[model samples]
Target chain A: MQGVRIQQEMSLFEKLNILSDAAKYDVACTSSGTDRRGDGKGIGNCKAAGICHSFSADGRCISLLKILFTNECIFDCKYCINRASNDVKRASFTPDEVCRLTIEFYRRNYIEGLFLSSGVLKSPDYTMRLIYETLWKLRQEYHFQGYIHVKAIPGASQELIQMTGFLADRMSVNLELPTAESLRKLAPHKSRKNILGPMRLVQNKREENKQEIAVYKHAPRFVPAGQSTQMIIGATPESDYQIIHVAESLYQKFQLKRVFYSAFIHVNEDASLPARTDEGPPLLREHRLYQADWLLRYYHFSASELLSEKQPNFNVLLDPKCDWAIRHLEWFPVEVNRADYQVLLRVPGIGYTSARRIVKARKFGSLDFEDLRKMGVVLKRALYFITCKGRMMYPVKMEQDYILRNILDPREKLPGGLGEMGYRQLSLFDDVNFREVKAE
Target chain B: MLKRRFICTDTTIGILSAIYDAWKMDRTDTEAGIPLWGTVQHEMFCEYYEVEENERKAGAVRKLIRERLGKQAYSDISYAILSKDEDKGTAILQTMVAARELADSHRIMEHLSHPAVRRVFEMSRNVGREAHYWEEFLRFREMKPKILYAEITPQNQVLPAIADHFADRFPLEDFVIYDKNHASYMIHPRQKKWMFMTDHEQKWEAAKELSEEEEAWCTLWKGFRKSISIKDRENKKLQTQNMPLRYRGDMPEYGKS
Candidate 1:
């Protein structure tokens, strides 16, 4: 653990800089899931789809006034920059300051709402109390109806957690790492049991509140947008399969709205952590995991279906859907005009919305290739998997190798750094072409 | 016989009136065309007639579409009228004409096989998406006397589309959003419903005078945005992709830095 340096009489500008910098590593910045209209007396409202005012240079949406209530901590987590053992500047904002900033920024359309997180200052109860007080002022006194996402501190009393959940739109408790063994290794002061305790509490309270609302018409909602959690990826030696399985259980058992995966950026040099490398955070792996995460949530795929013990990681060159489609080639050549909605979803280029549109539009008239393109289907990829009026788009063969060679076209746009990895995959075949050219 | 072309101004009432005239002249898609008043490109063998552009004719057309085509199609046609496309009037007129052939007139929007209906659908989606983008990227600065003022230069006429959202969100505050491209204003007084005004005189210099506390808050917001980004994960291409360059001119964080 590193020693913290307490700064005296910090200005609001400096406090905002230090505190928001501390909170940058906490990933969930979304303001979605809850839609609340203003009551004609309040100063703000929320949109269910969420609105992003700006995107930072890192390309992440600046949807909320994401800041820590304080940077002072008692715990010494190995991967954290604000651990007690590290020598970093510390600052805290009064509840008044947080409310004012949220109000002013939200009025200016700079943020959708406030995302308030804090370190375990003194005790979890004390920190949670401070958060509750701030939220109370923002909701009760200031009459702010906009989105509020707060962090439920692990090990806090159930009473305090329950009371705070009523005021927040969304609540989150960081799982920190995937497995209990890895959590014990990196975050010594924290335990998996302590984290899941508050998560379960929020879940049960929300269930009770739902019934209360059904009976009473207007009972104050308990985390109305639902609870979400995040875990740092690549921090522990867990495979993608294990991480996603954990996510699956969290979603099914606890009913989480989202599970964010942060590609662990090396912030501290600790013996327990992986050594520093020229390769930055595992963004490509994180990207793949999110793609698979969507598969689990929206595309009706199980963790085992996407990856098994035999293959535990996602393919770096292709997306999870395309990879799955290639491996299971038997599902190809689905008739567009007659295929069920579920079958249309499994096609490579068709999204959920496009599938729905196809289902609706085909009822009026049988759709052809041009109609599918207008309905937002990416024909470049779907041409191989789908047919129009029982005829394929082209005479392309349905062989796996043939499709893989064409699907991995250099013209296709890949996510940021993964394009280079795609080229590397193609270079394996390029070697034979190079040998032929050399002989010539 | 030649096609009958009705010319009108580029507005809701004008387009609706032209649609009324076209519907009266011919219910067939191939025989009638509606083009904007000033953007008419004279075609050979086409009889061009200027629409009267009155509220009564527009009202009758609006009532007819609402009663026959259902509320969803009516809303889609309304959004398509707000699009920036020059052929929007013709597309919508053809779409309504095509609806006459449907078994259930309300299901015309679902008939994407008709090119005219598909065109109206595409234009409506474009206008709706642009309006949503403005909702996300529009920045308001507190002007003198504590009035929130914003300016946007959107390609489509989106001021009317997004006025209700902001008015509901900020019912207690007096705000005015100026659409520079359309030269219109969406003004909402405190505790009052919003209204739209066009062809109004403007003094752009007066709106630039911000309140005393506005600069301080803007500075604080800019600092927070800067610190909230991780240095290790800086990707400018992704940043531009999410928040495009066109939207940065008015955002304080992206202004002059």
Candidate 2:
């Protein structure tokens, strides 16, 4: 890997244009869950319902001023545009430059916060320290009280991470690959242990700091919004079961707030990498994983329940909840009025809020299909699973193949574009496309 | 054949006063159904009973609500009154009467079978959804060093709901979030109180020109917006679904387009 040649001639705007463009591929741009009212002395506050100041062309939220501290790297990761061997124009922001951009953008309300990630400039420690200084200056000097989500570089010093964690609203360490073997194959410089080590440290310190703040009101918050991680899907040869298990374990072990799944877009032209196709990034797979992930987080679904070794992936035709319900037909025809909140949650069309509403609304009076529709339940899906007072919306068979055919029938307003998605069985031997997966 | 029509101002206090007046007349008789009308009505041959906005009368009704119903019920009525629904006034009044008779007004809110309660619930939900959307969609562009400004045209009167949010968000910076559709402005002075001014008497103007730094930030933001999306996965339908076309004019990225 060749050394980075820092561009001395780049203007601040030029650097912003380059670095922000470089940072675009990273998908964790959420600015949520830290509700801080601005102190009279500070410049900004954060709302728990994070504001999306703008929408990108890909329909993703632009809530933060997401930019790379530098595009210069010391490691040659094949998936990244900023790899040391890549001949991209490299620019690094001075701590002051980052602070100024953050403050200015925040003041104008162009962003809700700053999402500062970087490539390995010299070493993890050096890059992380620069990020820490930028955050420190933004918080202490500029008196910016908005949300800040910073990446905890793998293999960075623990002290630097702790310091940055205190300054940032949320901290994250990207796992990049689902398994260590894949990490070794795709990103030779990065190890699973190197990434998870800082994640564990942040988790422990955040837990400790939470206790400290609970006891002492004045103790400063350490990642008050908690931590999250991202995994690059389709880049590795891991099955959906493996990916979900990795995520589920991360949630249980490290106590991550979220595990973002970024669909891999093929970038580099290497003999070792798979050739790109017109099919593009595996967006449908990524979307399915996200839907499954939501089921895990909010719907009280275990990853194993959503997928197994037998069917190791989600069906592209139906959502995770509906698919699960159809596979296990015994639980169908749940009594809308009598079913508990948990049972109601498993119903295909009933969401968290709608399920809660059913429980609340039914106590006052009897709820029929009409009442359920008014409460925001999609009757087309829920009718097969739910009964109002002992009668189904329509007499339906409990047979799996029968229900599947009926549900997939084009007459029923299928979810989004699922109806048009050409049915193809999950392939075990299809040559996977090369997707440029970044761990940032 | 005397028609008792209640003419009232189009405000929370006005509506409450009208509700109080209407609630007192014929609690059970179908023939004596006192129809509530805002000042923006012109109905001939009806005996018009003008209900002025009185704090004492409104407070009495509010106290009755707090005593008979719960605080949640009180806020539900408050939020329901902000809806543009023409029948919201009568629906809330009917709910208040029905709710007063019930053992639990809170429980009555979930009784969707009842017409009055259902209407009130729907109106409140509409207001809540609109307010939640504005909390996300309201964009503030810097007009001066400490002053920020944005414009919105929401379906409901959601300025009051989001004012406290922006005030808490930017305590040190003054911002004016003008609701163009409702002809109201949520103005928060730096390090001071925030208020909703409904003086539609003066036409509000957009900031003539963004400051130099503000312009740069807008340009940078526009650049970031274009650069972020993967061209292969561009979904305009989903984009509009999340951020409706109504909000595009104020957004810098969509402003030029």
- Top of the candidates by TM-score: 1
Per residue, candidate 2 scores C-alpha lDDT tens digits across B3-93 of 5566676677888787677767755422222244532465556666778769887888888877777787787888888888877777777
lDDT per prediction?
Answer: 0.91, 0.81
Model 2, residue B62: displacement in angstroms?
3.9
Angstrom error of the Cα, residue A312, model 1: value is 0.3
Span of ten consecutive residues with least summed lDDT in model 2 chain A:
A431-440
- Candidate 2 wrong stretches, greater than 4 Å: A1-8, A409-440, B1-5, B23-48, B63-68, B144-146, B200-209
User: How good is model 2 by TM-score?
Assistant: 0.91
Per residue, candidate 2 scores C-alpha lDDT tens digits across A22-124 of 8877889888878888777887788776788767777888889898999888887778788888888878888898888888777656778899999988799
Model 1 interface RMSD over true interface Cα atoms = 0.7
Candidate 2 chain B: worst-modelled 10 consecutive residues by lDDT = B29-38
Off-target runs (Cα >4 Å) in candidate 1 are A1-6, A419-440, B28-30, B200-207
- List the TM values for chain B, per candidate: 0.95, 0.86
**Chain A TM-score, structure 2:** 0.92
Q: Tell me the tens digit of each residue's lDDT in model 1 across B1-257.
A: 88789999999999999999888877775668888877889999999888999999999999999999999899899999999998999999888888888889999988888898999999999999899899999999999989999989998998888988898789899898989898888888899888887755654343667899999999999899899999988998889998888977788877773
Lowest summed lDDT window (length 10), candidate 1 chain A: A419-428
Between which residue pairs do clashes occur in model 2?
Answer: none
